[model samples]
Target: MDFKDYYETLGLERGATQDEVKRAYRKLARKFHPDVNKEPGAEEKFKEAGEAYEVLKDPEKRAAYDQLGANWQAGQDFRAPPDWNDGFEFSGGGYTEANEEDFSDFFETLFGRARAQGARQQSSRQFHAHGQDHYARITIDLKDAYEGATRTISLQAPEVDASGHVTLKTRSIRVNIPKGVTEGKHIRLAGQGTPGIGQGKPGDLYLEINFRDDGHYTAEGRDVYFDLPITPWEAAMGGKVKAPTPNGVVELKIPQNAHAGQKLRLKGRGIPGKSAGDLYAVLQIAVPPAKTDEDRKLYEQMARQMKFDPRAKLGV
Candidate 1:
């Protein structure tokens, strides 16, 4: 879908403050109110102004919007980046009466569903005790935990309609990633759940954060470990070698006489977090094959001359 310039929609700059956004929205809403304006599509424009205000007014929503950046022109093709929803949250199946079809793909893609019209009425219908809470699991990356990121997750929920028939609704929501939010910690979004019945509040929506596994990065607790195999010569000779981490590859110094399975620690190089974590490089000694006659002769000569017998302890 083409991107909508929310700032432009309200005739504000990309860096417009929340108060500026709120003021702009009010001016536009008054100027374009369907009831006050005779121009065609005034209602549509007014609605757009309202939607933009909703996002730009709230700190959480505004932060999420700012993440999208001002580089995207209005009507530009848009796609969410890896960790777009860093610190906001949503619960209900994306669209509701309060902010239904009036919202844009950009808004919906960035935030949670708005309260539907007559949500109050729906709640009054009362389904006995508060309905059971809903559950959703959102997959985040290990780096997200390292440095607390935001994410917009898509979810589909099953619910029964007024006719007692079950239906599925899809919603995409944004949630803040708290520091050290390890796998399985539920991020709860209040008032963003299914409506309750007869004096019962709506059920809550719980988001469980899960980390996506990386082939190169093995994340355990606050520590990261990687195995790097080097030629026996590199282990024996003190030198700088390239080592990989979640951030990227960096030069690591291996001291002379470093042994196989020796571990080197790089402080504060793991995932991003408050206390952060460390990166460890474990050495694996690689033995080259004696494929050439010269290579075979060298091993044979060393074996014959060296006084260091590996079996010296086991006299036979």
Candidate 2:
């Protein structure tokens, strides 16, 4: 994809302030508006100005774009960096602020398809008195993300009774947990939320995902990390040590002279799918106590044989 310099399109510097961007967009919009300027390519120029302003106007989109770095020139070939917006939050309601049809393919690739078609369809209706939307949280084990599972979530809300009086209601609904769902992701249940008023449709339920506190491994997005404990001998002499991953236990080679907290990457062993995440093994050395006389003698003999001072770097 060729990079589009939004700042250049608006005749402003890269560090232009918000007010400057707005002013430039307004001036360019007026100059190229098809109705005002009947010149050739005026309509295309007007569309270009709108696209530039569309991205620069939104703070979230602007920040994401700025992450591409400043070295890129206009019309330079570009590909989005891996996991560019990994933890960034966008709306789960499938509604976007921008008109999805107007933006170019580059915009869609950077920012996902905005403006859900269903949302547009719903807006054309004349129904008034819509139902109130509901939100709830659901937590599951990390394994549930690897292998999909069904979870029941309970929700409490106030609903109108037959007597025209509001009453508290508690209900439990079974939700299917899909594989590869990470933390902070949501599951939308349409028409399963609060009941509608009059002839209006029921609102949808948004269930936010949370992982249980499992001490075995730590997860960041799709990547997983676990500590691999090994003896000093294993660290000094590179050996294969069995390490635990989300999938199963696998032999991980400890590099010679491996120090504590040293990491080794197991590519594509994390959350399953295309573009899967990598699993990291952090090395931790565990020393055995010299309790027995034989053990003490062996440790003393090694101490006398080896003239190693760990604090030599500290000048102690």
Candidate 3:
């Protein structure tokens, strides 16, 4: 998708404050409003101006957009980073005034999800008349998922100053990480969302769970997987070896003649549940480097004595 420079569309500078943004958008709207301008492309320009204003006017949306950095140029081929909005606290999904389809692809790519979510929240609120719920994503250690934990997390929401510049207002909350919680699971904190109108109750805050990439483990459903580095001798002569698990280190039995890429399952060792998931220790043969003369000699002796052809199965 092409990058749309919202500031440029509204004839404002990148550092323009909130008030400046509002004025520029108002001027553009008046100049190109379809009813006032009879030019062939005035209507399109009007729509573009509106789209730009839609994003630039909101502190949260503007702050999130600013994160793309100032290096990006207009019309450049662009794709938002996967975790661009991670940890950003947003209310009612940053609802937009118009249908998402009415905006350009650039706008939709940034705020479309928010618009859809806002629509759902709005629909529900019409009946319940509660405050809008907030949402955010919080990353926790994988061990926290295995063993329940209570952690204090900080979340930031954007606020606009009188000059229209965006600033982040941070708030800290204590959250309980339930044991066996899977990725994408949400922990709802009641009455933490936006304030309600009149006598309506405050909305909720939903925190989505994510695991940090610790470089040692990965999870799929209830199953956990990690590389268990084993020496070549261990692969050849199976015996007991120490292996690391989420809970702790445990002795694992390596069957005789275990090969690289072999998986050793530890039943009921994964994320705890009624039917607990298993942990898979994927074998990786670690070869010691022949840095010394003795090491080189030992390797040479093995190569000469083994006479094993690794590629024999390939029929080469």
Q: Best-fitting candidate, measured by lDDT?
A: 3
Which candidate would rank higher by TM-score, 2 or 3?
A: 3
Ranking by TM-score: 3, 2, 1
The local lDDT score (0 to 100) that residue 137 gets in candidate 2 is 57
Q: Please write out the lDDT profile of model 3 over residues 3-111, one tens digit for every residue.
A: 9988888988888898899899899989998999999999999999888888888887888898788888899999997567767787885565654566888887877
Show the lowest summed lDDT stretch of 10 residues, model 2. 86-95
Best by TM-score: 3
Better of 1 and 2 by lDDT: 2
- Assess candidate 3 and give its lDDT: 0.88
Whose lDDT is higher: candidate 2's or candidate 3's?
Answer: 3
Q: Which stretches of candidate 2 lie over 4 Å from their true place?
A: 1-128, 157-169
Q: Clashes in each model (backbone N, CA, C under 3 Å)?
A: 20, 0, 1
Task: For candidate 3, give the lDDT of residue 85.
Answer: 76
User: For candidate 2, lDDT tens digit of each residue in 210-303?
Assistant: 7776787877898888888899999999999888777788988888999999999999877665677788998889999998999999899989
List RMSD in Å for every model shown. Answer: 15.8, 12.8, 3.4
After superposing candidate 1, which stretches have Cα over 4 Å from the reference?
1-131, 159-169, 178-180, 305-316
Between candidates 1 and 3, the lDDT winner: 3
